[model samples]
Target: MILKIFSNNYIINITKSLPRGVYRILPSEEFKKDDIVVFEIPEETKKYLFDRKYVPSIVTSMMKKVASEKIDDVIEINNNNELIINSKNWGKVYKYDSYGRKLPEIDVKKMKVQKGEIFLLSDYSDRSFDGRYFGVVPISSIKYKVELFFRF
Candidate 1:
């Protein structure tokens, strides 16, 4: 499924915000928070949602900075190899395996932002399939940030 957009990269000067409608991906790397981005909707979400292959979303949360190796809080590594985050924030700590690796089940808070993931939200949440259900999206997946919308 391909997202259609103008092939030429150009910017238009306009004042009023365009009405809510379908937008094509105008791939760029200068997107900021709250910007509406277009990405290939994950296959998992497509099973029960929109029929389109690509979708638009608003960036609700953006990673401030890349995480470094620092222990801000302790976190437990569950049996599934998934990090269980009980609190809102995930601290900076590195996870590794030692000789005869033992999966530590410790209580801690905070989890670092891995892969610089961004949280997305749908413009029309009530009827839209978006980040609320898709979870955080990596910056690499964002194809474009919508600047204008059009309807036919």
Candidate 2:
């Protein structure tokens, strides 16, 4: 995340953040709109994972896009349980994993992000674990922002 040694190299991203591609990975903490950001798994999310989830081979970090960072941006879970942010539909809320298994629950009907946190979404992959499942994440969790250098 904050490692300079990981820079200046073509990092092939197979995660859900963006279409699988070769990207210029940067060690950064700044939040830029539409930027592909990387963050360590949220501590609040540990409750739902296995006991050894922190092991490097397991799920260490994840990459996702900020669905909406604008102040007072409204996030809503519709009657159908779809996630709509800032009046735009993001998709069905995180109810199932990529494998179709049922999962951790969220009960928010409407919310306005005043500060301290931001919502994230899978850039391309459906069922990608993100804010839709774990809910709004603190801004402090962001560790890096990546840029697409090439796409396959």
Candidate 3:
């Protein structure tokens, strides 16, 4: 099924991690904010996911779009589920947990991105396994940047 779902670097996502569509991934020397990139899961998170059975053992990669406004930016979330970067409205995120349970409105997080790290969020749907589950990933982890032309 994966063979039929992809060709070369092209991959079709059945999940709404990035708008629930196909994306063209390719090797790149660099990527900018808002560019979706294919990358490896951070080892710490991967282990936690495996130990907790949050993610299957077969999961090896992840697709996360860079959302940090820039290096050394601070990210904040309000009760309204808004992703505020550097005091400016950048985007929104899911307010509910995956199990349809109500989560704390006032997210106790004011994350500041550092050098060689990025802030990613799955803002398309409330059920994405991202949000509080994922945080500041290292830049060196990225493998390919997705082409924005494929409904990215």
Candidate 4:
């Protein structure tokens, strides 16, 4: 099994099956109701039709397009404490105090993002299965940014 680290979390292979699916991992507290997450299909399994590379992207794009109207503003703070605002609609903005802070328990109504934390975007407006379904995904699950792929 190949292991990947996203942020400070770890994504590992487990033999047991989960309610949502077959794979499972420890998630971060920051994972909320509808955060977008990427799952990489193992190289050995790529031959299957379900392993298509564009599947996830197409889903993400469609989700973004449908939720365009509900998208909220994203506020980014630069190193100099300058706040940069992007007009594009996003799920939500979360602030973390430091790089390795654990995600807090879900309390969407009362929870506020802390400084230095990451801001996550949910995939849809409806109660679709996502971060909320599985819980916050640990940063370790991320293997690396999807750069390029070569199929054998």
Clashing pairs in 3: none
- Mark the 10 consecutive residues where model 4 has the least summed lDDT: 60-69
Which number leads on lDDT?
A: 2
Where model 1 places Cα greater than 4 Å from the true spot, the runs are: 1-19, 22-27, 50-113, 123-125, 149-152
Determine which window of 10 residues in candidate 2 has minimal summed lDDT: 1-10
Report the error of model 1 at residue 54, Å. Answer: 12
TM-score of 1: 0.42
TM-score of 2: 0.76
Predicted candidate 3 versus true structure: per-residue lDDT over 112-140, tens digit per residue:
56777766655555455553456677778
lDDT tens per residue, model 1, 89-136: 222222332233322222322333345555444322222223323444
Total clashing residue pairs per candidate?
Answer: 7, 0, 0, 18
| lDDT of residue 69 for candidate 3 | 30
After superposition, candidate 4 runs with Cα above 4 Å error: 1-105, 113-127, 133-135, 147-152
| Per-prediction TM-score | 0.42, 0.76, 0.71, 0.23
- Ordered from best to worst lDDT, the candidate numbers read 2, 3, 1, 4
Candidate 2 Cα outliers beyond 4 Å, as residue runs:
1-10, 26-29, 46-57, 98-100
TM-score of candidate 4 on Cα atoms, chains taken together: 0.23
Model 1 alpha-carbon miss at residue 11, Å: 14
Point out where model 3 deviates above 4 Å: 1-7, 51-54, 87-96, 100-110, 148-152
